[model samples]
Structures are given as C-alpha cells and as structure tokens.
Target: MSKALGYKSFGGSDVQEFFSRPDLTPSPVEVLVQVAAAGVNPADHKLRSGEAPDLNGHLPFPQVLGLEAAGTVLAVGAEVTGLAVGDRVTGFALTGAGTYAETTLLLGAATARIPDALPETWAATIPVAGTTALDVLDQLDLPAGSSVLVNGIGGGVGIAVAQIARDRGLVVTGTAGTAKRDLVTSTGASFVDYTGGDVVERLRALAPEGFDAAVDTVGGPSLHEIAGLAKVLVSVGDQSVTELGGATVERRVDRSGLERVAELMVTGRLDPHITATYPLAQADEALALVESKHATGKVVIDLRL
Candidate 1:
C-alpha cells in the first residue's frame, strides 16, 4: 500500500487526513512515480474547501490533495516514451491521482526530467508556480523596459513573476503585505504596502506615467483597485478579472514549459525560494500555512524529511 494525504469529502482543513491505498498503475499516456516532494498551493485548499467544482465530474471518496510533484520514475506505461525507470522527473499529477502520495501517476506529456543540480523540493514547485509565471509573462508580451505592476507579489507565482520580469528587463513595482516587503524588494522591484491606505496614490508615485502592464495575483477588491493601472492586465488568482477588461492567465502545462523553467533555474535566473518543507506525514501542517495566506514563498512536502 502507498501512503497518501486526502479528504473523503469536500469541506475545510478539518477534513484532511492521511490514508493508505494500493499503488497506482500507469495508463498508456502516464508514468508511475515514487513521489519525493510535493508542492502546497492555494489551489489545494480551495479544492478541498469545495470552492472549485470537481473537474473529473465525480469525487472519488478520499480525493487526493496535491497537483504537482517531483520524484523518481518507478515504471512507465507501455506507450510511454522519453522516460525510463529510475529517471528523476517533475510533473502534474493525473486527475484523481494527486502528488500528495508515496506513489502517483503523472501524465507523460506534462512530465519533464529534472536537471541534476536542481533539488526535488525546488523542482516540485516548478510545474505550477514556475509555469504560471512563464505563461502569464508570455501572454503579456511586454517590451523591454516596460513598467509593470505585480499586484500581490509575495506568493510563489508572484515571486517567480518578479524575478522573471527583472530578467526580461521590465521595471517592476510590486504590492505586497509589509511582512513580505523584504522578499518583494530583493527581486529588485519597488515595493508598495497594500495594507497601507490609498494604494493607488502610492502606485502613482512609483510610476507617474502609469504602468504599461499589470499582473494580479490577488483577486477580489484588490484586483478591482489595480485593474485600471495598466493597459494590459492579467489575473492568476481570479477569473472575475475578465469582467473588468482583464483576462485570466494563459496556462501551458507541458514538458516543454517545465524544461524551460528547469533551464532558467540552472542558469540562476529563477529561484523557487521554497521557504518551508515538511514530511509527507505533516502535509496538513504545510497546507495549513499556505491556506492561511502566511507562507512567505513556497511550501513543500518532502518525503525524505
């Protein structure tokens, strides 16, 4: 049996628990992985809280709770190619076969081999946060030296956006809570404290000409407040940004995207900045930190911890 963390039904964090299940078998387009590390993101808690409708149409009692993982390939399906047993890889889990387990299934098309220099914990964060950052920036396609505002620039995706924007020669000004001020500024972004009153007033001081583009990682009123600051606006946290004339992020979850991120990491241009790692048995605690909105950067569950 393989150990895993999941919920029997949709609810709150109270519903999460550890359980055991038979090891998974890879489908024709899938590979079986022995998970070494898993990433914890807001999406995990949101799904468990029933905020998002079931994507697979039905919830298998004890639905797994993670989306991305990094580990070793234990086996590959007969039709799988480019991966072999004992290869190190990172990937998105197959629907219903989440990464929060000792063994899980990864779609072969979405999986990429990890560079020997990248640690599993950092690689685990690449599939979701790294790709989202790359896709959003590509969607914006701003010119070099463009002034961009990163609304809510403290989380995993936001941090990646800041670093990549800097590398791409964009002038970045980010709004984050005071707690994350140092982190946001370390990326060379001008930091604005969102908790402070009159955010627009502060933003105007940072960019008198106004921003050329904006990426919203914090939604609701926060997104609304900053929606007009830029000509090109994209939201990663909410789809409602579309109603305000902005579009949601363009997501590309494939081996090519993952490999690109790995290259960026190898070149020292991108850092996952994993702030905390817990053992698989302590996944709930790791998730609680992310769900609370207090995590500094990325939180990961390392099986070896």
Candidate 2:
C-alpha cells in the first residue's frame, strides 16, 4: 500500500485527510514515480476547495492533492521511452494521480530527466511555478531594458517571474504585501507594498511613464487597479483578467519547459526558494501556510520525512 494526503470532498483545509491505497500503476504513456518530494502550490488548495473543477472529470472520490513532484522513476509504461527505472526526474501529474503521495503517475511527455547535481526538492518545484513563469514571459516577449510590473510578486510563480525577468535584462517592479518586502527586493525588483495607502499613486511615483508589460499573480480589485499600468497584462491567478482586456498566462507544461527550468537551476540562474518543507504527516501545516497567502517562497512536502 501507498500513503497519501487528500480530501474526501471539496471544501477547505479542514477537509484534508490521510489514507492508504494500493500502489499506483502507470498507463501506456505514463511513468510510475516514487515521490521524494511534492511541491505545494496555491492550485492545490484551489482544487481542494472546489474553486476549480477537476479537468479530467474522472478522478476518483477522496481525490489526492498535488500537481508536481520530483523523484526516482520506479517503473515506466510499455509505450514510454528515453526514461527507465531509477532515473531521477521531475514532472507534472497530468494524469490526476496527484503527487502528494509516496507514489504517483506522471505523463511521459511532461516528465523530464533532472541533472544529477540538482537537488530533488528544487526539482520538485519546476513543473508549475517554473514553467508558468517561463510561459508568461515568453508570451509577453518583452525586450531588454523594458520596464515590467509584477502585480502580487510574493508567491512561488511571481518570485520565479521576478528572477527570470531580471535575467532577461527587463526592469522589474513588483507589488507585494509588507511581509514579503525583503524577499521581493532581494530579487532586484523595486518593491511596492500593496497593503499601503494608494497603490496607484505609489506605482506612478516609481515608474513615471508606466510599465511596458505587467504580469499579475493576485487578482480581483488589485488586478483591476493595475491593469492600465502597462501596455500588456496577463494574470496567472484569475481568468477574469480577460474582462479587463488582459488574459491569463499561456501555460506550457511540457518536457522542454521543464528541461529549461532544470538547466536554469543547474547554471545558478534560478532558485526555487523553498522556504519550508513538511513531512507527509504534517501536510496540513504546509498547505495552510500557502493557503494563508503569507508564504515567502516555495513550500514542499517531503515524502521521506
């Protein structure tokens, strides 16, 4: 049997529970991974709370809860190639098998081999936050020296976007809560505290001519307020950004994107910034930290812990 964390029904953090299940079996194009670490993301809670419908529409009840993981491949389906048992890798759980468990299934096309030198904890964060950051920036395709504003730049994807933007030579200014001030500034982004008085006034004072592009990680009224601050805008947090003339991120959760992120990490161009790791037993605490919106960097669940 394999141990896993999940929810019996959609609700809140209080709905989460632990249970045991039979070992997972990979499909013809999937890989069976022995998960060493699972990246905790806002999407996890969003899916658990019934805010996002199950994309597959076939996930069983008492749904498992995670999207990305890094570990050793224990087995591969008959149709799988270029991977083998015992390969260290990172991948998205596109099959809806979920990663917050001792074992899970990863789609073969979305999984990529990790460099031997990269730690599994960091590799675990690549599928969602890393790829999302790359995808949004690539979609914007902003030139060097252009000014960009990252609305709500405190979370995992936002932080990755800030760092990647800096590397591309774009001038980055970010809006974040006061709790994340130091963390945001450390990425070389000029930080604006969103909780302070008059956010637009503060932004005008920072970028007199307005930004060339904007990527939002926080939605609702704040997104509405900042939508006009840039010529181009995209939101990863909410699809409602479209009503305001902006669009949601163009996600690319493929092996190439995963490989690119792994290369970046191997070359010191990216950091997952995993601030805290929880054992599978304490998965609730880890999820709570992310759900609270105060988590500075990435959070991961270590299955071996």
Candidate 3:
C-alpha cells in the first residue's frame, strides 16, 4: 500500500484526507514512479473543488492531487520506450495516477529524463509552469527586440515566461503586485505593479505603440484590460481569450519539449524560482498557499524530505 493525500470527494480542503491505497500499476505506455517531488498549482485545488469536472468527473472517488512530479522510475509498461526502471525522470501524472503519493504513473511519451545537475524540486515544476511558458511564447513567436507583456508575471508560469522571453531577446515587461516586484524584475522584465494605479495607463506609458505580444496568466477583467496592449495574445487557462481576438495556449506535451526545457534548466537559461516547499505531510499547507492565488514563483511538495 502507498500513503497518499487525496480528496474523498470534490469540495474544499475539508474533503481532503490522507489514505492508503494499492501501489499504482502502470498501463501500457505508462511508467510507475516513486515520487521524489511534486509541483503544486492552482489547478490542484480547482480539480478538488469540482471546478474542472471535465478533468476529474469520470475518475473514481478519492482522486489524488497534483499534475506534475519528478522521481525515479520503478517500473515501465510494455509499450514504453527510451526509459527503464531506476531512471530519474520528470513528467505528467496523466493516468489519474496522481503524484501526491509515494507512487504514481507517468505517461511514457510525456516523460523525460532529468539532467544530472538539476534538482528534483526544480524539475518537478517543469511539466506545467515551464512547459506552459514555452508554449505561450512559442504561440507568440515574436522576433528579437519585439516588446512582450506578461500579465500576472509573479506566478509560476508567468515568472517562467518572463525569463524565457528575455532569453529569446524579446523586451519583456510584466504586471504584478507590489509584493512580487523583485521577483518579476529578477527576470529582467520591467515590472508594473497592477495594484499601484491605473494599469492600462501604466502599460500604455511603457509601450505607446502596444506590445508585440502578451501572455496572460491572470484572467477576467484583468485579461480584458491588457488584451488591447498587445497585438498577439495567448492565455494559459482562459478559453474566453478567443472572445477578445486572442487564443488559448497551445500545449505541446511530449518528451522532446520536456527535454528542451530540461536542457534550458541545465544550461542556466531558465529557472522555476521555486519559493516554497512542503513535505507530503504538509501538502495541504503547500496547496493552500498556491490556491490563495498570491503565491510568488513555484510551490512544490518535496517528498524527499
């Protein structure tokens, strides 16, 4: 049996509890992993709260939390290639075999081996935040010297987008709260405190000609407010972006993409800037911080602790 943190039913944190379950069995094209670390995101609580039924409604009760993790492969399925037991890897826990446990299953094609120098905690954040940043920037495809705006640049994906965009030679400007100013600027992005004053005017003052592209991590009126500031726009989770003549991020989930980002990490071109970590026993606190929507940079569950 494996000890796991999961919700017996979809609701709030009240529904969460720790329980024991049979060790996950990998299906064809899946790899069984002993999780070393797991990335915590807003999506975890959203799924647990029944906000994303399309993703969890069909799964059995007591569904586990978490989408991304880094760990050692304990077993591999028949159809899996390029991976074997004992390999260190990072990938998505896509089989409803959640990563917030002692063991889980990762999709074989989606998993990538971790670079020798990378820490498991940092690799754990790549599957979601790192990949989303890559995808949104790829969707924008602006040339070097183009101006880009990152809306909500303090969160996991936003911070990553700022860094990668700067590395790509795009002039990056990001809007975040006062608390995240240092973090946002650490990526070399010009920071706009969204809470300081009129955001539209602030943005306009920075780019009177409008930005070449914009990547939004925060949605709603905030998205609408900045939608006109960029000629091209992509959002991480908000599909309503289409109504504003923008498109949702096109995620490319595959080993190559994962490896590319891992290479970036190894080469020192990108950083997840994980600001907080928690042991599995305190996974609730780790998740609550991310669910609060005020977490700066990445929050991770480090099972190794």
Candidate 4:
C-alpha cells in the first residue's frame, strides 16, 4: 500500500486526511514512480477551498490533491518509449491519481527526463507554474526589446515569466513586495515595488508611455489598477483584471508550453527556483507558505523517499 494525502472535508487546513492506499501498478499508459518531491501551489488551495471554478463535482471528499512532482520512474508501462525504468523525471499527474502520494502512477507523456544536475526538489518546482508561465508569455507576443510590466513577480511562475520574457529580448520590468525584491530582480528584471501605495504613479514616472505588454499573475482590483498602463495583459487568474485594467487578457497558450519551457531550461535561459521545502508529513505547512500569498519562490514538499 502507499501513503497518500486525501481530504475528507472541504475548506481550511483540516480538509486533508493522510491515509494509505493499495500500491498502484502502472497501466500501459502509466509509469510507476517513487515521488521525490511535490510542489505546493495557490491553485491547490483554491481548489481545496471550493474557490476554483472547475469543481463541478469532478473530485469529492477524501480526494487526493496535487498536480506536479519530481520522481524516479521505478517502472515504465508497456507501449511506452523514450522512457525506461530508473529514469529521473518530473511531471504533472492527473492520470496517476495525484502527486501527494509516497508512490504514484503518472501519465507517460506528462513525465519528462529531469536534468541529472538538478536536484529532485528543484525539478519538482518546474512543471505546473513553469508551464503556465511559458503559456502566458507565448501568447503575449512580446517582441525583442519590447518593454513589459509583470505584476506578481514573487513566486515561481512570476520569476519564470520575467526570465522568459527577458530571454525573448523584452525589457522586462516586474512588481514584488520589498522582501521579495531581490528574488524578482534575480530573474534579471527591473523591479517594481507595489507594496507602496503609489506604484502605478512610480511606473508612470519611469515609463510614461506605458509598457508594450504586461502579465498579471496576481489577480485583484490592484492588478486592474496597474494594468491600465499596459498595452496587452496576460493572465492565469481572474479575467476581470484585463477588462478593468484596459489591457487585453488571455487565459493561456496550450499543452505544448511544458515541452517548450523544458527546452529553455535545458538551454540555461530559465532555471527553477526552490524557496523552501518541508517534509512529506509537513505538506500542509508547505501549502500554507505558498497559500499565504507571500512566497518569494516556489514552496516544495520533499517526499524524501
């Protein structure tokens, strides 16, 4: 049997129930994995709290919750190629059940080889938010040397967006609180401190003509306020940020984003940043850090298998 985190209730930290399940064997399209690490994301909280829009009764109480992870493929199912037993891989799991398990079954295509040099903890942080960043930026159409303003540049996705945008030759400018300034700037982006009340005014002073493009990973009334100075806005959150912010809002690109970002990571243009890690039993703590809305980089759950 395998130990997995499940939720018998909804809302609050008490929703989770860590329990055991019969050890799962991989099907033809699945790969058996020993989870090395899992990522804690705001989306996970949103889903658990009943705040996400797609619930529609798809998952019920006692359900496992998680999306991405880094692990070793203990065994590969038949009919799969380009992967084998003992491969080091990181990927999202919907087909393998979930990532919050000691061992999991994962969709073959979702798994990809992680670089040997990257730690499993670091590799685990890349798939979900990294792929989302790739998708958002790809659709923004920022051209070489174009100026951009990225709001919410404090976490994994924001940092990825800043770096990818810079790699594409854009003059990337970003927003982060004072404490997270260094992390945001580490992505080689010009930093904007939005904790101050007059950030929009400051931006106008520095860039009077407004940015050529914008990304809003933090969706709120404030996002709309700042985005009024941008020509186009990309998002993975509330669309109202665009309608009220005066910039075009797009949801995402496509599934191809994951593979594309992996290429960038391999080429050294983008790197995964792991801010903090908690043990598997401390998964709840990790989730809190990410959900606190203050994580400077991706918060991770180390399975330590």
Index of the highest-TM-score prediction: 3
RMSD in Å for model 4: 2.6
- Please give, for residues 124-167, the per-residue lDDT of candidate 3 as tens digits: 99999999999888888888999999999999999999988988
TM-score sort, best first: 3, 1, 2, 4
Roughly what TM-score does model 1 have, to 2 decimal places?
0.98
> Over all chains combined, what TM-score does candidate 4 have?
0.90
* lDDT by residue (tens digit), candidate 1, 194-278: 8888999989887777899999988999999988889889999798998999999979888999999988999999988889999
Best by lDDT: 3
How many steric overlaps are in each model, in order?
0, 0, 0, 2
Looking at model 4, residue 300 earns an lDDT score of 86
Residue-wise C-alpha lDDT for candidate 4, range 234-270, written one tens digit per residue: 6667757646654334433222455566677778888
Clashes by residue pair, model 2 = none
TM-score of every candidate: 0.98, 0.97, 0.98, 0.90
**Residue pairs with clashing backbones, model 1:** none
